[model samples]
Target: MVSLDLRRLRFLREFEERGTLGAVATALGYSPSTVSQQLALLEKDVGARLFEKAGRGLRLNDAGHLLAQHARVLLSAAEAAEADLAALGGDIRGTVRAGGLQSAARRLLVPAVARMMAEHPRVRVEVFELELEQALPGLRLGAVDLVIGDEYDGHPRPRPAGLRFTAALEEPIKVVLPAAHPLAGAGRPVPIARLRSDIWTASAEGTGHHAMVVGTCRALGGYEPDLRHRSNDADVQLELVRVGAAVALMPPLALPADDPAIAVRDLAEAALRRRLVTVTRETPPAPALTAFLRAVTDQARNS
Candidate 1:
């Protein structure tokens, strides 16, 4: 009788989700040739052809699909079993693979990780900086165990099945300007229309923040912004504002404490805010993950 290898099944499932052996290898920290060799060995062990050539690439055959479906269940069960064992041991110890946007990584995740390291010395965490769009699919594909993301008031992300979301923080989005700018010392909330003529800096197109900036300007000012600079880096945006090159809309969480060269003001609309959320699979979380999540929430509250 032939036995199935869980590691190979994991590779197969990753291949199914990623649509390429190279992607699977990258996610799993293996070489492409190793991934191909392992899959070929799996096919031999199962006595079936698992993949077939399609144009310039390879795709899973019917047998591969069926096995991959079972692999999902088996892999989930394996995780469940590990969780059970960890619970029995009564010690929060394990490695957690997590990912998040750059702002969250700096503001919330980094501090939380520090606290976790001080408290649970045995728990390990690996973090990746990923865009919100990429992070969600990474969760589904098992490339990341947890993810942190943002949701604006008007733009809601699509929540895929078999996942959980926990709200960590909610803060208003503010307009940022150089300290020497005319509007910096304005005693009242800054109206969107007031900055219509000023050059702007924002995240690149296709990002949620860019859409928010454009949509808000169109709704309030009746004109599109002259976006002169584009970057996803919060510090870079703030720097642009500090140098009087451009103004931008930014969240409070992304700001540094008491910067002398920059000023932040509330939007006149008062309804533009974003929620920071932590996402994980629906399965019972390990103790380390539970602890890490708690730490992240605490950090957000304190920040």
Candidate 2:
């Protein structure tokens, strides 16, 4: 008899994550008494203490830690097997949860979802409008099965511990300005170095793109821009520019759909490309997810 029951393993994982039995019970929709009894049964079968009291809460013992590690893998395998079985049937089918940046969701991801549904009626794809920072954590936690994320110039891409990534699109850095701004209709692209004194809004601090934009400006004979605004939201930053509030820089893919007051211009600075990445766990991408990513990438590339 295996001590590794799915229910017990799930309870242990939930307990470790929640830090209290009450929270675990709430999450699993079970009473505290039932949870305690099940854990006792699991411990008896394993012949080891699974946890020890730590202040007001329980912490996993060494044996529990060991078992917890395997539990994640086992849970993943079970899901993988189910996905495999679904693929074996005629149409690729299953629910796939993906997360990505706002523009990608608005511009690129919804189109992808429509195509996925048309191609496989049985498959369901869910998209979360998220920042890339949130997507990485979710992928690691097995919360999202895939992510459409972007990588910028300076920061290293996360090799999500046990995931593979591929390029979905390459985004170019662009200078966004109000239609009335002097740079809006320039026939030739302006060098970043020449725009030193332009009032500027920037991406939120600490992001790879944010750092790249600042670093590029400094390297190109530009000093720190007169900081007008800082935000992770590209559309908001662009709106600030659209109203002639300030000029902001962004990747072309992140531009808003329509703005009579706004115009996007390519930055001719060398090596200024950013990559959009499709991230998936090391466990093979279920066919439905694969089809969705591939179809979206192709559609986005062509259109």
Candidate 3:
């Protein structure tokens, strides 16, 4: 095996994405001939065929793909090394953008943001409300710096290429009911089966959360309760419960206050616990992100 360069692997990726060397040169501000020369040097140095011609396009062979994967890791490490060097100086200033699902923003991120602001005054953080899948792609495309997401509704898989994540917390789903409701005041732990008659004010149809709730109810010998209304907002769901419109499923973390209006009933099995994670394409997270995740993780622990 010959000595390979990160620059060459980067070129191959750009070539694959761009589909032409001339376009890669134009985008990279290098002449076409210089791009070709660098690639030739790279190929000779590596001693493996990096790409093959397919009509007017170039595609990576198996070895080239594997090398590209490793190249990404090396380039990321190099970038982090540079950032670490820069951070040794007095001033550490940059923006970290993040996105998460609506529930996380309401129950987790808002407090996390407050703590982050108090601790890291110099760093600006902007958090957006988005679904997990929506946030994951942005983390990959470099559109957002971090994503707070969940894995529930029975999804368990390897992380996508070029991204990393930290497990923040595992929150269980609770059954919410009006305080004066039939099962709320019952002494010896109200049976989960009794929940079927309650009109459930749930999230919209076809979402993972909704599916999970429905699946759990069915599994535990409960009738899929009447879904009178659908909403993603915890506050609104609480209001519906207060008005006796319906009951709602809530995470234990987002349990409503002991209002005469609502009671949170913890479920039976651990299978309903939703795992929340913070993700980034950055090999090493920005300082702001680290601090924020730490605070939220601590909060999650306490909760």
Best by lDDT: 1
Global lDDT of each candidate: 0.86, 0.76, 0.70
RMSD of 1: 2.8
Residue pairs with backbone overlap in model 1:
none
Best by TM-score: 1
Residue-wise C-alpha lDDT for candidate 2, range 1-303, written one tens digit per residue: 655777677778767666778876765557998988888888987888999999987788899989888888897797688678867885788788887877778777888888887878888888887767656645655568777777777655867456788788887777777888776775467677667777788777766667777777886645876766888777788878877888867877777667778877777676577788888877766788778878778866974
Better of 1 and 3 by TM-score: 1
Candidate 2 ranges beyond 4 A from true positions:
1-61, 256-260
TM-score of each: 0.87, 0.78, 0.68
Clashes of 2: 0
User: Can you write out model 1's per-residue Cα lDDT over 183-298, one digit (the tens) per residue?
Assistant: 88955688899998999998878778888889889987788999989998888999999999999988988898799899888888656988888999888888888898888889
Question: lDDT of candidate 3?
Answer: 0.70
Which residue pairs overlap in candidate 2's backbone?
A: none
- Candidate 3, superposed: residue stretches over 4 Å from native: 1-82, 152-158, 222-225, 268-271
The local distance difference test score of model 2 is: 0.76
How far does residue 44 in candidate 3 sit from its true spot (Å)? Answer: 27
